[model samples]
Target chain A: EAGVVQSPRYKIIEKKQPVAFWCNPISGHNTLYWYLQNLGQGPELLIRYENEEAVDDSQLPKDRFSAERLKGVDSTLKIQPAELGDSAVYLCASSLGLSSDYQETQYFGPGTRLLVL
Target chain B: AQSVTQLDSQVPVFEEAPVELRCNYSSSVSVYLFWYVQYPNQGLQLLLKYLSGSTLVESINGFEAEFNKSQTSFHLRKPSVHISDTAEYFCAVSARGGDDKIIFGKGTRLHILP
Candidate 1:
């Protein structure tokens, strides 16, 4: 009955430091996504996981950003050597995996607010 | 690749007044359209979505949007606005096939006045 859950509601870090955000999706959801939302802008897809497999990550900045969903239930998004521009809210969402019978309606978590100085 | 455009950056209206938020998309393939609302410090919530069947979709909160293939637009409207409805509304589009990665617009901030 609980919705998606995320950890560390807020975080502040200096430039060049490392930061991480965690997320726990709704029960029975097989698809997980990580999105970055900057101020005055809509959320942008960073990565998506179908079960434990990352299907899309082109939008992710490989040099500094990385994500993983080991058990296919909870996910973690990390940014190493964070920059000022990396300050934003990181949102996690999940949905029923796409299949013949499933319709993907992603439910989002509260999100982690990150501030990089 | 798909992209969404929210024509208005912000919409201000009085309570009980009707309002419309415009959204347009560009895609080469078939796609699914969605509208999401985000309250201050909250996550995005689905308002409505258009998958196939009907070109018109309505949300439980009295919000409705019609998908116009000719105009390539999906404009959200509400017959009556409430102060609680004040929030940031996002327009998103996703490919019907492929990875289903959603492309979101800049967002339209709706400010309902009392």
Candidate 2:
């Protein structure tokens, strides 16, 4: 089966510029997540979507970062007026199970590496 | 809150050498631990996980990890590694009864030299 898909494998932009990253989860997956991975570090969860609803977003920078998963299939993570610190790999992942009782495995996409100068 | 830590940032091992990557977690409640591997220019893939069954778990490609509850550790191990095993491995944990938020540790890069 085809895995989760992400666009723009790499992106470069100057500081204060807005950027958007797109992600399409696996066909049958129900839970979608967005994570940020800085160089030499593991991914940190930015937001999580249970279908069309964003169930968790406490880690998201509300001032500049925003995300949306419409129709519960695809998602878009946006960073407005991004700073140099925003330069990182944006990874998108999806899981098939939504229930907490069953911890399902998450499949990831080829992340979009963003560089802000 | 839960957190994960990978003690080593990088480990260099020769081909056909047995290797182990150490991982430790801290949580107030029960948690599910995972090991994800990322190859060069690729996305992270799940290598193995510990949920609720046996303390030992093995991946299809020969990697194995034992979940030690008392030590609060889940270390990845392989009997013998090949060059193809070179990759960055991440250790992660999420509280079993909490909000399902996963915390990842800084990755450990495995370098296999022939």
Candidate 3:
């Protein structure tokens, strides 16, 4: 089976500009996650969705970051009026919903590398 | 809440030599441990996982990790490594009864020398 897929492998934008990243999870997977990874640091969870319902988003910066999974298959993460600090890699992962497995393995995508100047 | 710590930020080893990457975790409840590998410019892939089994787990590429409950450590070891083994490894943990959130370490970058 194909792994998770992400679009626009890279993006470079000026500060205060809007940027968006897209992701498509593996087939039959019901859980999707968006993570931010800065240089020399591990990826941090920004939001998690279970079949179109956001189950966890405490770590997301609501003032500038927003995410949505309309069909429960593909997701979009957007940053409006992004700041210079927003430059980093945006990773997407998927797994079987928690209701299906006690601990499911997450499959990751190639990630979208964003640069804000 | 759970947290993971990777003691080494980078490790350089000669080809065909053994290597060990250390990982420590803290969690109040029973947890699941995972080791993920990310090659240069690639996505993260599951190297191995420890859920409720024997303390030892091995990956297909000759890498193994032993879960030590008392020490709270899950160090990954490989008796022999190749050039392809060069990558960054991350240790992560998720509490069993928690909100299914996974906490990851800073990651260890392994460099294979000739």
> Which structure among the candidates has the greatest DockQ?
2
Give the per-residue lDDT of model 1 (tens digit) for B10-86.
99999999999999999898889999999887788999999999999999999999999989999999999999999
Q: In candidate 1, what are the lDDT values of residues A1-117, reduced to their tens digit? A: 999999999999999999989999999989888999998889998998889988889999999999989988899999998999999988999898855221467899998999998
* Deviation of model 3 at A31, angstroms: 0.7
Report the C-alpha displacement of residue A81, candidate 3, in angstroms.
1.3
Which residue pairs clash in candidate 2? none
Q: Give the per-residue lDDT of model 2 (tens digit) for A1-117.
A: 899999989999999999999999999898999999998899999998889899899999999999998799999999999999999999999998567532678899999999999
In what order do the candidates fall by lDDT, top score first? 3, 2, 1
- Candidate 3 residues A2-117, lDDT tens each? 89999999999999999999999999999999999999999899999999999899999999999999988999999999999999999999998855332678899999999999
The TM-score obtained by chain A of candidate 2 when compared with the true chain A: 0.96
> What TM-score does structure 3 among the candidates reach?
0.97
RMSD of each: 1.6, 1.1, 1.3
True contacts kept of each: 0.52, 0.63, 0.50
DockQ metric for all predictions: 0.55, 0.66, 0.60
Give me the overall lDDT of model 1. Answer: 0.90
Q: TM-score of each candidate?
A: 0.96, 0.97, 0.97
